[model samples]
Target: MTIALRDAREQLRDRFLFWATLALVVASTASLVTGAIALHSDAATYAAARDQLLALGKDAAAIAAPEFYPLKLMRGMIEQVEIMGAVIALVAGYRAAAAERGRQTLALILTRPLPHWAYRLAKIIGGMGLAAVSLGIVIIATAILLPVVSGIGLGTDDALRLALTWAAGVFYLTVLFTLGFGLSLWARSPASGLIAAFALWILVVLVAPQIGDTMDPDNQVAGGVFAQLSVPKAEQDRIKAGFAGYETFRNGIEVASVTKHFERFTFAILGIKDTYTGAPVDKVLAEKRGDLLFLFLFSLGLGGLVLLRPINPDRLTKES
Candidate 1:
């Protein structure tokens, strides 16, 4: 507990955490504003078109009023998490390990009365605590700002979905944090850890998705390539089914990317899945079980790596 509190204070004093938290808040606020404007414009356009058709003596179905879903409004915020959130986690982890080494405290800590695992647990707790603080700010700010901007009240389901999205964000960031922590443990210097961490981030978060799309052109854009070909949905499905093996391979590559899992999990939880929107939370969870499991296992795997890291006092002394 003492070590955890000290580490937390150290992290709080670091400028990076403050800046990252500020950026998240700003990004979330921007997403809410952008979503509200888009929704209102869409509502207006639909209403105008409906009026035009009715004036032409054609029956038009009444358009439903746009409902403000806070989670939906946070789409951009979630993407920022995929990018900046990972960066924050990487930086935090690297700094934690690198700082100990640079300050020559690593050997002293290892020689302390406390077990080595306890020190690691303190670091983990401190790093994840900062992450939770940042994510909590994002969630709370979004929840408060969304309804104010959209003038729509959130129902119980919306609150639940927001909670679920928060969980996904925590899981996603935790995975990235541990990845960096493990790398920092292995790397000789903070620079090396940062480089390796960012490289993995780029590969998993950016390149993997692009590779998946390139491998299966149908995934290159939204609505599938068949939409551009003007094929019916049924035909598109049939054509895609014909390339089942290739599609499976492509999906495997993507699923292997933790970033992809995070995005998919967040989308499911927040009702960004078109077919699953307005569905019960249970349905979303059921459909996204694979993604959730992948994220959980990935996090545990990295954590295990950290826990199993060599704790030789001689090595620590030499490194320090």
Candidate 2:
């Protein structure tokens, strides 16, 4: 255990690790500040819009509803936080193993009595530990700063939701780091490993979701389904015509109501809904955690295979 800790400490002491941690801290702080400001600005605009609607003879109940503007601000902040988390993870993962490979010290380090897997595991733990600390600090800072700037209180429920979101972010970062380490082992060169890892990250994190969305048939709907529902076409047309302008009014009402409802509920500290369209977010989080664990095992498995391969030091010296 001591040996492992020493190895991990040495890894973290490296210049690259120091710089990476610094970068994560700076970037996370900036992201939180920017997100808070933007959310506050949006909330102010929404309040003004709500007043205008009320002035136009909309009932106070309709204009002052909880779902009107607050939810939008919260949702936008969540998205920005996720993006910032991804950036921190990606940068940290690319540097984890690639830097050592670039220095050509990987082979020397592997030759030690300490197991190769131990070194890899220590790097993974240390890198992720650092990232986790940064994430926690950002969350804490955001919680305090947002209320001050936006006048939106952060309740226990908000903290819980943010915690779950951060957990997901950490899982994603761990997977990327392990995969990057594996690529480093394969390439035996830091630059090549970094490039390949980032390319994979982009494919998995960005492109895959888009492709998945496009491939989902549910995203597309045809007019034929409604037409074939056995209702009289004339009756359907009459209903549609009667409600021609209803969509706009209904949307406005929904927006106002939801906003107001959430605002009151936020004060009550009601937890966020953990499921989206029948899919439990907790289940998704578990799956992601499992995936990250598998990736770490795979990286270790490959690293062990690399270690088992016989290396002829004499042949290398002769060639040199």
Candidate 3:
């Protein structure tokens, strides 16, 4: 616990990490604010139209009031975290291993009361705590900003769903942190380890997400292809069934992307996906479980790799 606390505090005081967290908050806040403004405007327009219809003697009760989902407004928040959060994890991991490799500490800790497994676990615990608390600030900001931006407060269910999405973010961040931590420990130099982490981040967080999104047939057209063409659900399924092989290939690529899984799981909870919007919490969980599982597997795999290292003090030592 002490080590964990120390790890977190060091991160809090880190100049690079401070700026990264601030950037994440500012960027995501912008996204949430923009989405909220759009929603507020649309709702206002709908209300005005409804009022005009009623003034003309039309039944006002027949028209539906606009539903404002504060949680859905968090789509931008999710994106910011998806990109920046991974970078933060990598940096944190690089620092954690680097700290242990210091001249005064490496030999003593690796050879003393702290076994390599215990040392690795403590670092991970500390880093995980750091990731959680840092990323958690985004949620707090969302809660505080949502009402102010959208003129709507979060409902209990909305709050719960947002919490679930935030948890997914923490999990996603943790997996990346583990990756960075493990890779740095294996690399000959901390700088190389950090670079390697960023390379994978580019592949998974940046490139892979683009590949998956563009390959999505629905996304081929603005506002979704099927919706744009006014295709019925049954027919849409039929059309999709005809391209089973292509879809399988696309999904295969998406399945390989940690970013896509995080986005999928988060989007479903936030109701960003029209199909999942207004769907019961249980339904969202059941359907999105696969994506969450992939993230969990990443955490597991990276963690195991970290733990299984030979525990050599020489490896943790710096090049002389």
Number of the top-ranking candidate, with TM-score as the measure: 3
Candidate 3 has its poorest 10 consecutive residues by lDDT at: 311-320
Candidate that beats the other on TM-score, 1 or 3, i.e. the better one? 3
Residue 276 miss distance in model 2 (angstroms)? 5.8
- Model 1 lDDT-worst window of ten: 311-320
The order by descending TM-score is 3, 1, 2
Question: For model 1, how big is the CA root-mean-square deviation?
Answer: 3.9
Q: Runs in model 1 with CA error above 4 Å?
A: 41-70, 228-234, 312-320
Deviation of model 1 at 130, angstroms: 1.5
TM per candidate:
0.86, 0.55, 0.90
Candidate 3 residue lDDT tens string, 1-320: 66777777888798988888888888888888887887777777888989999999999877887666668777888888888788888888988887777554766765677667777888888878877888888788877888887777777888788788877887899888888887877787877888998899899889877887788978888888898989999999999999999989888887788888999999998898888888989899999998888887888787878887756555565643
For every model shown, the clashing-pair count is: 0, 8, 0
Higher-scoring candidate on lDDT, 1 or 2: 1
Question: lDDT of all predictions, in order shown?
Answer: 0.78, 0.51, 0.82
Better of 1 and 2 by TM-score: 1
RMSD of each: 3.9, 11.5, 2.6
